[model samples]
Target: MAASSDAACPADPPAIDLRGLTKRFGRTTAVEDLSLTVGRGEVFGFLGPNGAGKSTTIRILLGLVRASAGSATLFGDDVRDVRRAHRHVAYVPADVSLWPSLTGAEILRLLERTGSAVDHEYRGLLVERFALDLDRAAKTYSTGNRQKVALIAAFATRAPLLILDEPTSGLDPLMDREFRRCVIEARDRGQTVFLSSHLLDEVEALCDRVAILRSGRLVEVARIAELRRLRRTEVEVSFTGQPPDLTRTPGVLETQDLGDSRLRFTLSGAAAPALRTLASSEIQTIEVRVPTLEEIFLEYYGGQDR
Candidate 1:
């Protein structure tokens, strides 16, 4: 994925900016000293495990909750001034709940009226694309359908900024694809997207940059490629004879004896030194496993010292 064309520089005010944002509830701190920026027209991912402060940060940005300290801004306007900043924003929560007596179409119209502008043509297109049945009452719709309704409304508003909190939670695989497409289309139209998700694959596929949080603290923020570079590959080797001793090999982080002439080790950085070490043994079979996004995420939690 390429970086956003309008990525905010040092001198540029970001589409969304949070500086030392903190939130507390009595004795518990939900967020702490967190800060980041989402550029104009960027699909930025706020990623973390459950209760990792993703929702708290988003709520502050949306002005649904006031931060205990620090500041948040939308399009250069302080989010504390809710009305003005919210005029350019649209939000879709993770768990969507609509008025039970209203039909999907009615709900859509109501949401549209709240926004500054609505694209009727785009609304119609989204309804069709999501395969939503607008005639049905809201209470009769499934969780996925309710999500579709919210998505359609958000996309149709033509808002300059979209805040989607796990927007694909109840969507099937097919609808998930359509949702991603809509996000990309929004980006193409110069809209900024702040996507909060625990789904690593979704973030990897869509985001220009990702900020990872752990224990209510920001852990890392980098492009996907840069994050991937931090991962180490696992290599398993089986030999006809004795396995080569690789304890001192460069780039080899750890080694394990799998017994019966088999060995397992993790290789970081370049594979050249590891490969040469493996070649010294009578290799019968070898397997190299690339780390998955989940594994990389766990690594951060498991070894914070990294």
Candidate 2:
């Protein structure tokens, strides 16, 4: 009998589920009390700074490394017993290595042997889509090209779940954009993608939800829309006359003169009061901009464990 689609998706379980997952390297605790849930077909961003345990968490989920405590499930099976479940999942690590003696085609063939069934036509399409030079030996490929090979092989599997850790680390801007497009297409095709990166802009652009980790602990998990809403806005104003006093404004955080009657400032908590202040000023030009994810990270991670 043929295997059912549920077998491919493993009971239609959440793509990733963890509870109090922890990992230790000798005396160093790499992950601590981390828990997260990623829904099927959702692009979930796992974010943190270096040594914050993001990679360790992904490794634990893949069963590449055992957890020191707690439990994790991928596709409804225990993380430690995911040999079958792994067939439904694909992983792209930050640092991808390919054998110098093999060609791109050879590497992909090996991957398919360990992964799900492959379609030659689909593989060709992936090669073209990723602009890979398959005829070249692995030793000839640059870092960015090697990353492309990894991405192509993983995505070509068309698995139900993808665990990508810094998958675009070596790509240029254009390739990065292309990679994101591919991920978007996969999500539309009902594939779940768990993306781990320190790049907040990437997270903001591709993720439906994000989980922030700090010093091996799960700090926050929120919808991307909600996190964007939580972000503060920046308002800059130029007055025809002296800049108005903003210290008394309810939402205003700080104001600095930008010379020639212009003032730049940041605001949080509420926007209404800031708008009112701007309206009352002898304003020549007023600009209000939302904080980028990087700016928000600096604010949130300052003096903290992230």
Candidate 3:
């Protein structure tokens, strides 16, 4: 008799569903047998390097491109029946396509008229939150300013679903924080956000779960907390005199010496033992730092610093 294997259960009323979704251009297979689900009101992050079919998958989901094989359902409606579900979903692309001649106010009015009723109060709040100068013409704004305009327009609406592709491309650090706040606010209001971005940190900060793709293949789907469990912490200890030998610590991966009476090493697991070890010694100071999303991104992509 063969041994039984654990089978993953299907999601209950998925917010977004793709089963065996495949796309092809002549001989090139853009996406192959990709199946995934996102729960309602969850901020799901799609992560991948350049040309990893991220855009292709998004285009198919938006009904902008036809899939060669398989099916997609957004909010329980068939992909072919997109118009029915599209009203609930709003998409912000990497390259915003606002009319160059249109003023910020004009573009906002147009998008609002196309979709459901505009939330004037929310729009005003977003303009102020993102620090967007609505008086400027679309063509005259800088990259960051243009990004602000797009963000304000997309987030101002009370849409149930938001599909943002590289949403914060040109924003400064402060604006990025504002963007995060907006996402959180939307999630709190029961809105589901599907974000595709190269900025892993933003994903780590904002997404409840993240799906990593490598070479058009889905490599990993993990929760933010679970992914953080896989993170390594760097411990730096400065000694009043000579450094104590930390060669025997169980989770210690490596250790190095700093010229200024300091030693640094990495711990693959908990920092409790490392802290205990340092406390026992005549340490002047100690610093512990966790791995950033960028570092984790490099590791998952088969880059160095593993």
Model 1 over residues 69-136: C-alpha lDDT tens digits?
99999989999999999897999999999999999999998998888588899889999999999999
Model 2 lDDT at residue 173: 91
Whole-model lDDT, model 2: 0.84
- Error of model 1, residue 111, in angstroms: 1.2
lDDT of 3 by residue, 48-156 (tens): 8887889999999888899999998888887777788687787888887678998888888888887755579998998988888887889998888887777787788
TM-score sort, best first: 2, 1, 3
Q: Highest TM-score: give the candidate number.
A: 2
How close is every model to the real structure, measured as TM-score? 0.84, 0.86, 0.83
Number of colliding residue pairs in model 1:
0
Off by over 4 Å in 3: 1-12, 133-137, 239-248, 257-261, 273-284, 303-306
Q: How accurate locally, in lDDT, is each candidate?
A: 0.90, 0.84, 0.84
lDDT of 2 by residue, 1-306 (tens): 887766655356677889888888999999988778889999999888998898888888887899999988877878788786687788899999999989998899898899966657767887887788999999999999999989988887778899999999889998898889889988998989999988789889999988888788877798876665687677788888657878899878778888978899988777788788777778888888887767766666797543
List ranges where model 1 is wrong by over 4 Å.
Answer: 1-11, 236-249, 255-264, 272-288, 303-306
